[model samples]
Target: MIAYRNAIQLGDWIVTTDNSGGIGEKMDDLVAVPDQITARFATRVALLEQWAAGAEPVAVLLHNFSGNASWHRYCEGIRDVFDEIGITMPPISGSSETNMSLRQSAVAVTLMGKQKLESSESTGDWYTYGTPLVGEEVLTKESEIASLTVLDEARRTGLIQRLWPVGSSGVLAEWRAATGNPDCDAASPLDVTCSAGPATVVLLQIDKEKLPNAKRHFGTLLHALR
Candidate 1:
């Protein structure tokens, strides 16, 4: 397997994996949220990474450590995201740890997708497609979270030259990684160090000439990174 960004290339497929822990309805978990929500957001992060890299997900492997009772809720969360993206849910399979009682929730999602070769280079200026949000704020600022439908629309319309979902490393770190400019965080408009939680924000590169159209398309969800 060859690693490209967070995904790995295996034969003709690209695979990406992400995991979450300690944030569920379990008594000893760090955050008291539903297992479904925890699984949903965790799955969202991995899925966003796959989609941003231009992969069509075909399979999912879920790792559940929360207990047998939490398995259905986690699956529900996984399905919720698939429904949001309007894709027929892919085949899902995984394992659950039922031998020992766990104090916290732990889950992992791995997506395997087909890779499509890019014929041209992406040329454009960078922009942010959502605000940075984390923790309890993610629940409270639901509207600020980036929408998968919007991302799909932008990609279909050729408005998004490239896409990068922001994770726990926050916007600045991702911006630097995306641009190969380690010191460019000084120019960001949002909190450079704030975690985006479950990819609540995405970095988009669009041609400057198309900014108006993109702005019109994305509305308040888009913010200039500069």
Candidate 2:
């Protein structure tokens, strides 16, 4: 089941759903919002007023009740309309569930427009490599160095162009071996630059506990790209 609402502020608008009840209870239900859903809602909430008056783009949070493709398509349609109207669109990320007792599935949609991003400076090319500190570290070091080379090459060729120091020593060993110079401070959580076009890349050393934080961290990296 799905419920919706719409509004407009001056000229801009928003359309949202009210599907907060347990997933099973609402799965088969469908409720239609107004035709000018996006516009009316945006206006009612003052989102359009702010945007039309040249205010910075607003951050929108959307939680989907169903993880089906049809729901995603509907969201896309609304996003397309917003894009045509020149409003800044930010990506919506959330999870969907089948029932109250069922596991949840996640869904995400990327929105575009001009807006301030928090982690802008952290954007850059990234290369990562890691080696478990186990017994007889000699063989591990050799294997780790080889793996770092692969990551370094990915950065050089632009396949993986952002840097986060999730694993520094492993990465540095590769960088040091590749350049044949120990001057490159691969240990530092600083960005490294390529002499050519995309100058500097941010390096990060990440592990399991840091995985959940990647989204926000990477979001900042992407903001820098823009």
Candidate 3:
């Protein structure tokens, strides 16, 4: 029998299976792990050993939406254990687009310790960080819309925005809108432009005064643009 352990998020919430054999059926209330202590692969390995017993090694699939150094480190820890057990672990996969059937199984690990798909200042904005806007896999139109929605929410939460790159045709328009200083004709040297969508390039300019605060909201974006 392929017994499976619970799905764990980076911050330490565990989604265990209930007696109904249903996957991700939250049995007990969500338990909170201490802030200082994160989950260790050793604990995961022990749980897997007990669940699988003497049966053939089960395939442990780790799903992530965003690929970052921290996630890489966590996976490396898992790999170490799998190597010790002499089992060929299943390939790790990532997807920014969501599939209804795989909802509970897909684990999202963000540095912010929040599950919401907001842009991270530390990680930088997705586009600025040069991290693929979505996962590498080709997505359907619907999935693309969903992905955009995630960004939109982030923008609304003051976590992200589609800033115009400098030197673009719309620079004047964006500047006017952002700074509300249309009468001032100050030429900006950094004339970089970012394509907001097909046939639409926005002028990108950053206000130095807002840099520090913006960095706190979307460091990845600043990194990419900088």
Candidate 4:
């Protein structure tokens, strides 16, 4: 239920969306940050969901509530995420609310992608990539966040059985839910229930026998769940 929430199957396509609010350069926002950074992380979440599902993204829809002036900067942020995956920015179409003044900033990104095929099953262990980071911590701990480039390459090489992005539920929660092992008490160095904020962490199902190669492939980004 956790992994399946973001992206859904629609015949040959998968449509997914992700959102963020109150974390921008707005007067009443919970976390004060740039609009560009806000949109970038929000876009990254939706794109990662599509990518993890083996979908080739075709279009993007953005909803901007910050202000009319923030639209262009939001687009730039979205494009920045696309650049990280080494793909051309998809056509973006959305609206901006400029009629009234809003206290907090809000944004949502929806991605439409074609699912080429189903993913393979792994006969190995589950591991996490990146530490759970939320709000201001996400801005400061850039090195701990998972890499889209690395994930893209791993999916292409068939090195992972399944890829699950960690959201607000944290690593252990996602792992247990995805594996259907609700009672699993795996040793973890990370907080089991902290928010991952825009999916900075991802759960990778890799064959136990291939752990060596996975270590080489993921480098320092990989961490054990057990």
| C-alpha lDDT score of every prediction, in listed order | 0.84, 0.31, 0.30, 0.84
For residues 1-226, what per-residue lDDT tens digits would candidate 2 score against the true structure? 0001122223233232222222122334232322223222222222322221223334544444444433554355445545545554555555444454323322222222232212122223323333322122322343332122333333334343223321223445434543346675554332332211101122332333434444333442321110
TM-score of 3: 0.23
Residue 177 lDDT in model 3? 44
- The predictions' CA RMSDs to the true structure, in order, are 2.1, 19.4, 19.1, 2.0
Considering only N, C-alpha and C atoms within 3 Å, which residue pairs clash in candidate 4? 124-208
In Å, residue 2's CA in model 1 sits off its true spot by: 14
List, residue by residue over 1-226, the lDDT tens digit for candidate 1: 1123777777668788888888998888888999889988887888877776677789999899988998899899989989998988789999999999888889998888886644356788888988899989999999999988888888878888888889999888988888789877535667868899999999898998888999998999788877
Candidate 4, residue 202: the lDDT equals: 92
Q: What is the lDDT, from 0 to 100, of the residue 93 in candidate 1?
A: 95
- Candidate 2's TM-score: 0.25
Q: Weakest 10 consecutive residues, lDDT, candidate 3?
A: 17-26
Clashes within 3 Å, all models in order: 0, 31, 17, 1
Q: How accurate is candidate 2 locally (lDDT)?
A: 0.31
TM-score of 4: 0.93
Model 3, span 62-169: residue lDDT tens: 444222323454466445544544455445543433323322212322111112322222222212311211111212222321122232233445443333222123
Q: By TM-score, who's the top model here?
A: 1
